[model samples]
Target: MRSTMTNLWHPVIGIQISDLGEKRFMFKFFHRMGLERVIKGSPWTFNNHLLMLYLLNEGEDPLRVPLILVVFLVQIHGVPQGFFTEALAHQLGGFLETFFGV
Candidate 1:
């Protein structure tokens, strides 16, 4: 049977799934597979609620968000490729280590 989901592609990366290091690609994949819309909000709100709380606590300027998040935005908007040549490395290392006994 043919796959119903649209294939996720990125210009520089070619096929996105081939670069699992790009977390943003996973979002696009989920979108094409119809899983993104099954939930309430789009990917931007995926972690906003929690991050908002962190921002409220830290009193950090929203303009000064950590680099990891900015990387995601940069990747999405196709900003200066010279700036962010790649996505941040695997963020779940410690979590996976803790949960899955890696």
Candidate 2:
């Protein structure tokens, strides 16, 4: 059961699910700051074309894909600092400790 749940939520295995969680967090944070509607209503439409272009242009460097996606996310969406902040590690640790008592 534990393994099943972990596999279901794991970032490496479930990219869109993981990204959705991150996106929700970002959306809420920005909404609180009065930017969510603006971002969502923006003209930018995210698609796989850029990823395909990157793959074709850069060949197969594993790190390139994620880096490009991160850049695209930041440029297209006005995500909050907390979303990519260094403090995330500490907060994540505290969250795990509180939830799992680990």
lDDT winner among the candidates?
2
Query: For model 1, how does the per-residue alpha-carbon lDDT over 18-72 read when each residue is reduced to its tens digit?
Result: 2223222232233333433322222233233311111112554434444343112
Any runs in candidate 1 off by more than 4 Å, and if so which? 1-40, 45-55, 70-102
Scored by CA lDDT, what does every candidate get? 0.31, 0.34
Q: Which residue pairs does candidate 2 place in steric collision?
A: none
User: Model 2: how far is 82 from its true place, Å?
Assistant: 6.7
Summing lDDT over every window of 10 consecutive residues in candidate 1, give the lowest-scoring window. 1-10
- lDDT of model number 2: 0.34
Error of 1 at 66 (Å): 1.2
For model 2, residues 4-92, the per-residue Cα lDDT tens digits are 32343332322211223322211112122233333343332233222111212335433333433312222224647568566765776
User: Best candidate per TM-score, number?
Assistant: 2
Please list the Cα RMSD from the true structure of every candidate, rounded to 1 decimal place. 18.9, 17.2
